[model samples]
Target: MRVKKQKRNRRTVKFFSACFGFREPFKVICDGTFIHHLLAHRLLPADDALAKLLGARVTLFSSRCITAELKSLGQSHSESLEASLQLIPASCDHEKRVNAAACIESIIAEGNGKHFFVATQDIELRRRLREVPSVPVIYGLKNSLLIEQPSTAQREFVKCSEEKRLHASVSEIQILRKEVNETDQGRDSFDPDQSSRTRTLKRSLDSTEKSKFKRKRAKGPNPLSCKKKKSKEVSIPSPNKEGSVPAKKRKRTRKKKDSGLEQGSGS
Candidate 1:
């Protein structure tokens, strides 16, 4: 799908001196070419011209990468490069250095709020810096220093870049949170003591068996049930070696004995 380009509010044409902190010192990031040009053209006092034009003090900054470039530029310019290096009070020394263009761009991008200016005559470098919003460029034009203000499109580009950066950061945070939750679940599910768990299970089983045995022992035979079984056995006939008396004979003997005992008690 083709998306429409949204327009932003057009900022008024305001000079550098009109902005907030316009009077504050602006940092100028220099490259090897700019330094060599400054030395060759005898433009050491160009900083004063820039300050006067922007209505602020100009502080020069460079990186180790630019210094390396100047060194490679050779023995003829070494003295001039040394002199220029003495003038710069600050530098960004990265362990893994890149070209002067990339280093300057990164330093400016990191300085989100601070005012910055790029001093270079490289056409490609100027074009790249122009893509960044609100950054001023200083270059030697017709043997004179000139400054270029950023366009509205550049500012909009910067806004969109920042939004994309913020969205990526939020997604990274969510991914990290999910990873942490999964790690916690793995830790909780782990059983650190296998032997202890097995022992506990055996102990529980033994206790259950003992409880069942005790319940069975507590339920004893009933006395009435035992007496009823003995009476039923005596009423049934028992066979002897010669002959067993019938159940009726046993009952007659028992009756006679009971009657005799009752008569004696009455007398």
Candidate 2:
């Protein structure tokens, strides 16, 4: 009976252990924003509470972008009061930073002698940290901490890209197949030049339908040409009519009475 009771107790302990994460608190990879926000919001007491729970001073890494962005507002040293932090410079380039982060996590592991938690605003970094078999990543979400395994897919960021492509070419091909299957005869009468020719044909057909025939009157010869012909005929004058004699005007009339009287008296 004691042996059975001992086995049950062991099972119960294992169940509770699996359900609870960071029950006594552990390590962290701290994000600057998370820490600074705690400071700005006057959550310094909470920071002390967390640090006490973890049994160590919080660690900070230098992300140049994060620092430059925050430095614009003159808040580079904003988290000084939260906990004693160590700044390790970080890279924005993913592969470069992942290796760097892995190195840091490994070093911290040696000092702490176990998997210390990683805190960051970068999901990609979190995933990379998770892949390390020794260094499990612990993330700060809102007010709590979540520990999870790394993602297999690495991440990249693109800004305002027109060439963003996916491996989803198969879906496009599937859509084409569905349309083509619906009408196999669509290819038979397919006219590639149809759009270009349509406007030209429409214009020509409209002109032909609207055209009307008109029989025009022939134009007469110009008046100046007729006047010129008359002037030429006048220049070539005919025989003069005044010089010619009529037959009746040609014969002479004698003094017949006077001659008759003298002949009669002489006789």
Candidate 3:
């Protein structure tokens, strides 16, 4: 149960931190009733308990009006008065002391620009604080401290602020329209003389470029396309046999019939 409560408190703190720009070492303004409750409940060393509840280091604050209210409670709240006195004094600037609730309300005003966390046991004060945007309220439940969830007014304020950021304002729209008109006027105001001068300059540049390069002239057909000339073959004569002496012919001799023919005659 304690873990759940702590988680809920942390989530609330994160919501304020992200949307409302609550920074580290938070400033908490404690009223008389809250101080008395802390002492009565033995929630001593107020800073440490509140710091743990806030999930960040905290600087406890008490206005002069709150201290005076605690002091008027006689000896029963002397200890609470001392505790309130020990806290850092928030600027009330009140020449005459007012009720603690009234003083705190004046400090917060409509928007909590200083980003103060109000710790009070007064139900009316807590209800009133809910109407103001970006003001986080802290109150004690039994021995535990809890931070209030953002009220509907605060949520609506956040939504409205976000929408304002997403869209442009009338002044910004007017400025943009003026800029577009100026650009359009600049484009519409064309000078004929300037255009004629530019055209002449361009013509001159073209003529100069044309003169720098020579146009290609007609040429003969490619040598590769024409037929190649055939080389002449000169006839080389061999030695004449009629002018030279002829070689002599060799005569062959035949062998005579032997004893085979004589033996045939005798048979």
Candidate 4:
């Protein structure tokens, strides 16, 4: 298949898997027309062709009603009947044989809880299947097989379900509020004595914690900013013997020779 076609098929498969709970080894229900188309187009071995188109392993299925309807078409559709017989038979719970389209629709029902992918060439059957949520339809286009994109109904259904999940309804909100109020009332009606004891304990614990971590007082002036005090040095005299005299003072005498020299000059 071309890359673009393969990518589109993968995206469709992913959407079904994520939103509709489709898993690996996908289940497919083959109707009479699809089987006939496969034989007519030389696309024999329905399982492999479907597996390749789906990008996963697939188990081909056919209901008893589909096989019976194909048989009723006579030997012209012998090969298609043989191909349909080879597939696993799905239970339609119908005693009487029905049209292939109706049989397939019955199998899919409302939600397609079986997660069956319907492979058919009938345009009307495909249209009907699209209206039902979570049913993926596969159709053959000439030599290539194609999976249809999610239909409007399927997309709208997914959108609505997602909205419901994301936003609670008024009734749901009221139920939640009622639960919360009930829990609150239960708490308020609990033992009052124990509650008072708990409150007092909490207060005492807070006070003790506060006292344990006392706030520091503003510090005194920084020692680095204070002036250093000057130290006084005291001089002590050396001790002398008790009888020893203290140091005496020495006096200088003036000479009379100057006066004598003056008298001699005068004479």
Give the winner by TM-score.
Answer: 3
Clashing pairs in 3: none
In model 2, where is the ten-residue run with the lowest total lDDT? 153-162
Predicted candidate 1 versus true structure: per-residue lDDT over 73-106, tens digit per residue: 7998796568557656444657786788877776
Query: Each model's TM-score, in the order given?
Result: 0.48, 0.29, 0.71, 0.70
lDDT of 2 by residue, 34-113 (tens): 45645555655644634543344544344544444444445456454223234555434433333334444545543234
lDDT of each: 0.66, 0.48, 0.91, 0.90
Question: Candidate 1's C-alpha lDDT?
Answer: 0.66
Which residue runs of candidate 2 sit more than 4 Å off their true CA positions?
1-25, 29-31, 40-42, 46-77, 80-114, 149-267
Q: What is the Cα-based TM-score of model 1?
A: 0.48
Least well predicted 10-residue stretch by lDDT in candidate 1:
1-10
- Tell me how many clashing residue pairs each candidate has: 0, 1, 0, 0
Clashing pairs in 1: none
Model 3, residue 13: what's the lDDT? Answer: 94
Clash tally for model 1: 0
Candidate 3 — worst ten consecutive residues by lDDT sum? 238-247
